[model samples]
Target: MTVALMWEARAADGRGAELLAWVRRQDLAPAPLRRETFRAPQDRVLVITWWDAPYDAALPELPDPPAESVTRAVHRWRFEAVTDH
Candidate 1:
């Protein structure tokens, strides 16, 4: 099975660039099959990682940034691929 993990966060005030840099510096042990990063108008940063594993399997994910770097807690989600269609 294939699993995708989504991680999103909003940077504090005008610290979007700093937050993005911090996210890019993170390293995932046993890296995923694929990974991507994105940013939005509201200083929001998003990261998605694809892995070859069971839906319920424990997977590596980006951790939250330092308290002063973000406006709130990070958001995360996990989904299994639906390729039957």
Candidate 2:
């Protein structure tokens, strides 16, 4: 079954762009990665990654990085492919 991983994070005060660039540099060879941003009243960012397979099966491991140092909050979601739909 294919899964889509949705990640939402808030960057530190003035480092949103920098953090985003860093994320784009990560090696996502086998799986594909796509990102988008939303402009709400309160500046917020959203990144959606589509994986042909489950996270543990196809996604690459991330390098050492401090969570609190870069993001304020994070969320992940997994979904099954809509084969019949």
Candidate 2, RMSD to the unseen true structure: 3.7
Per-prediction tally of clashes? 0, 0
RMSD of each: 0.7, 3.7
Error of 1 at 46 (Å): 0.1
Candidate 1: regions farther than 4 A off? none
Using TM-score as the measure, the top candidate is: 1
Could you give candidate 1's per-residue lDDT for residues 1-73 as a string of tens digits?
A: 9999999999999999999999999999999999999999989999999999999998878988999999999
Off by over 4 Å in 2: 33-43, 54-58, 61-65, 83-85
Would you give me the overall lDDT of model 2?
Answer: 0.55
- Model 2 worst lDDT run, 10 consecutive residues: 35-44
- Scored by lDDT, the top model is 1
Tell how far residue 4 is off in model 2, in angstroms.
Answer: 0.7
Q: Could you tell me every candidate's TM-score relative to the true structure?
A: 0.97, 0.58
